[model samples]
Target: MSEQVPQLQQDPQQILEHVFGYSAFRGPQQAVIDTLVSGRDALVLMPTGGGKSLCYQIPALARPGCGVVISPLIALMQDQVEALQAAGVRAAFLNSSLPFNEVQDIETALLHGELDLLYLAPERLLQPRTLELLTRIELSLFAIDEAHCVSQWGHDFRADYLHLNCLHEQFPRVPRIALTATADQRTRGEIAQRLDLEQAEHFVSSFDRPNIQYRIAQKNNPRRQLLQFLRDEQQDNAGIVYCLSRAKVENTAEWLCQQGFNALPYHAGLPAQMRAEHQRRFLREDGVIVVATIAFGMGIDKPDVRFVAHLDLPKSVEAYYQETGRAGRDGEASTALLLYGLEDVVKLGQMAAMSEGSEEHKRQERNRLNAMLGLCEITSCRRQALLRYFAEEQLEPCGNCDTCLEPPQTWDGTQAATKLLSCVYRTGQRFGASHVIDVLRGSENEKVLKFNHHQVSTYGIGRELSANEWKGVVRQLVVRGYLEVEGEFQGLRLTEACRPLLRGEESIELRKLPPKARGERGESRRDSVAADIDPADEPLWQALRGCRKQLADDNGVPPYVIFHDATLRGMVQAKPQTPDQLLAVSGVGDSKLERFGEAFLTVLRESQAAPVEE
Candidate 1:
């Protein structure tokens, strides 16, 4: 290395306060930083909005030489570097987004020991020249973001993540830290194994986001359901609506915009420019909703998102949790609304059958789908059911989910279920839900009549209930193990568990969706950012946000990079009078206080003098 910063005293607490503008480390952060600084590896499984970045960022500043971050995507790298640079940290990234000359400049900075941290895409970092040059430098430590990508079974598996084991092989002496917001025990073990951090200390933070209110409804009219939810419950909120297919994403986005919502579509099928532009708007603008497939939101850092709606079923519980976890990142009151039905299960099954993975892999995927179905159909606390899937639990019912807030009613569906099961049996179990529903509703549809099944005794018996109700019964049957999906036939079949109910030897109670639960429920608390400000400080909050927006626009980064809403909330709560007083705010790192502290103090002072409205 050409030269290094003069040796300076370093401690995690000192770095936390002076470099990051935080007074203390969040859960397990201090321990993680201490471990990495002492020349050891650490595996941290913190939830979203849990400050996982600081687990390594603080240590990167405290240690000598430069920290190397192996990020997954170019956009993520760019965002991180912009945020860090805004914080007055000398950070740079070498990615395809950078032009040739810019890449050369970043490389020079790394070699000359001028950068505090460097972000590299694994594919580029593993190249011969990049690896050789990195070997020539004096390195501090490595931080692997989105570490779950290393697991083959994960929703966002990346082939390049499989090659990260070389980090241990090449820089054997440099300490390392791997971080992910979503990972069950299995994924965690796989992450540690694949990254060659088997000897690292593992920290598992609780996988709960209490501020997010959970709700799920049967998908009778998904578009109308989502629009109604948006209009009634959480209008003017930035959110994400996830669909199962690219076509659905496009249709939903168009439909939403026609209804006067600022909606955008994001999927792999779209052109890269279009996707980037849409993501930029969703990140930088206020109250914009992006209707997307699961391909988006892997590395997003937006903290003020108010909702995440699912138009169709996700492939796995982990995928569902990770996607919904995207909302309420700032610990604000938010909503995760899902609308699912029999179609979701059938579609997921068909996709699994058509997938190219090994039979064992397909089987595991199918099991995961079934687990997601269980979560949707659960009559108890949605949060508890969700947490239990990840091997976590809550001591009591969480009042934040639909089931717990307005408990669902149950009815003896044994009779309705019997008719549905018998319809499947008498039809030779050769029909999917639509055909079966037609048969049950006594429709003389071509398929049902063509199959010579109109004479079946069970036909028309389910006509008492509407077509939608019958579909609900079938869905519940499938969830309760009374019926099973046959991949080869693309049809439903009666399971052994159906015999007891069919013979009247057993009773089954299916959940009845409470009408009250579907209606709007009052938020348990005000928005975290909005609640922190007094009525007198509301003007100041707006001024601070406006200042942040301007700075973010000038710097060409998201507003949160300048100062997160939490930081702004702290400023309003403390009402700091001077730059020195401003340093006491949670996110006011010394560099930030020096750069933007004076401007914020001016706003606070001006707000105090403004006349109050009667």
Candidate 2:
């Protein structure tokens, strides 16, 4: 009801109520939204699902005419546009997915000032025709979604985003807001510069998703581990199971379905209709499991997904974080499960080395992959370790993950770590984890024999630990900074931190990884919102929305302009039986009350009240 803007440019609280139907804004949403609506640019580095969309979407609506949204993915644009439409915002999109006629229709609507927002892929926006059309439209502001794509080092980089600078060039008067769910300092600079927003404000939210439980499992019996995770931790919960290959995606989906879950496969290799069907099923049906490859997630908008299980290691931590954050969009608790092994690390490393990037880019990619590997092998509290990698400080352990819930046994691993480091040193630190492991086990393989690694004093010293256990120890050492893997030629090398352990100057505590426990079996609670509502209020709210939608259609406006969900909630509580009474509601201006209040109040009057206790 308050009309005053915080900081004189944005009223994020009001935007929260009016556009997003929420009573309050989440962390950093208010501040970032405030900066942008005040006619300034902002570089936002938030974790996925950290309400990044609301930062721009709400301000776009609150400001004025159509907001031009430049997004990276066509699929993402489509999903966002659908969500905005569902919430009764006059939103549309023009992308490769739309036919010429549909594009023309949207263009006409934009020219007529009928749309509040228009979403476009960066590639489409760069086209001369699209740019020309944008110049003629009543533009309120420019919003760049997934702005990190402009950075060459970013995981999802697209060359087209570099052209977004033209918006700033052409429309210097229009305030530009660039937003991304994932970005480090490097990517942030690229976003600001590439979008010509160096002078824009920067709003960096903490990179934290406290609601999502992070877990990593050794890939031994991964299928079984995944099944158990689903059965125990996520029984009858909506989730996505990601695989690296299409064949694996299909097989995993089939396996899950055979195990009596509502499983479906989705991959770029699938028939278009099949992919769409699986996506629809995942969205509409409760507790359906979508077994998919990386191609499936960029555009997904499902809010109540309970879990995201990775059957293989993700290419990088950024990609993993973004994919897993899809669960628990409603601010409820969720889980992100990763199943990985040394092979996964090697595969990812090899893939990174093969990508068509410059040497420096490849090196950074390897660093990111190594960080993911460290996460998989970390013995400390999973959340603390993950948050720390993102440069966040955490004082205590999160008591939700497998490591924290069932603490692993601690053993002094200083000697073993020293021995591992010695092997790397003696071998000239010129190999991968597997070769290091082979040398530690005193393998007489061709490579080991050719290098004469058996001559080292530390050779076969690790015979006391199993290959798997030794690997866990070595991985912990890497993650803990006792050792570092050199990116050039994928060398396993020791860092200065290793000096203390090797010299007995420090003792290293290692947790003996226990066998992963299976998740709860059988169907559990699925989105159990209270079925009961105030009987008088239910129909009235529905009727209000209905009337609003009808008015929106008649006037070529969005339903939210008539009444947002917050207003509807207020109406239900106030139970205003007449337009005059409705006009007394907090947000009701006389003009709006006169124009649209009577129809909603009529519906409110017709609704029956629930029986009240005396």
The CA lDDT of each predicted structure is: 0.85, 0.75
| Poorly placed runs, candidate 2 (over 4 Å) | 1-19, 414-467, 474-508, 516-614
What CA RMSD would candidate 2 show?
Answer: 7.1
lDDT of 1 by residue, 1-614 (tens): 22323243487788878877887777888888778877789999989989998888888888888899999987788778888897888999988877899988888988888999999988988899999998988888899999999999889999999998999999888888999988888899999889998899999898899998898889867777787788876677889999989999999999999999999999999999999999999989888999999888988888889899999988898898899999999888888988888877877888888898999989999889888888888789999988888789887999989899878889999888888888898888868887888888888978878887778887777788887777788889988788878866568998888898999998889887545234546643334458756777777788999988987787788888889898998888888888888888888888888777777888888877778778
TM-score to true structure, per model: 0.95, 0.76
Best by lDDT: 1
* Lowest lDDT 10-residue stretch of candidate 1: 1-10
Per-residue lDDT value at 323 in model 1: 95
For candidate 2, list the clashing residue pairs, or say none: 228-519, 231-520, 232-519, 232-520, 233-519, 233-520
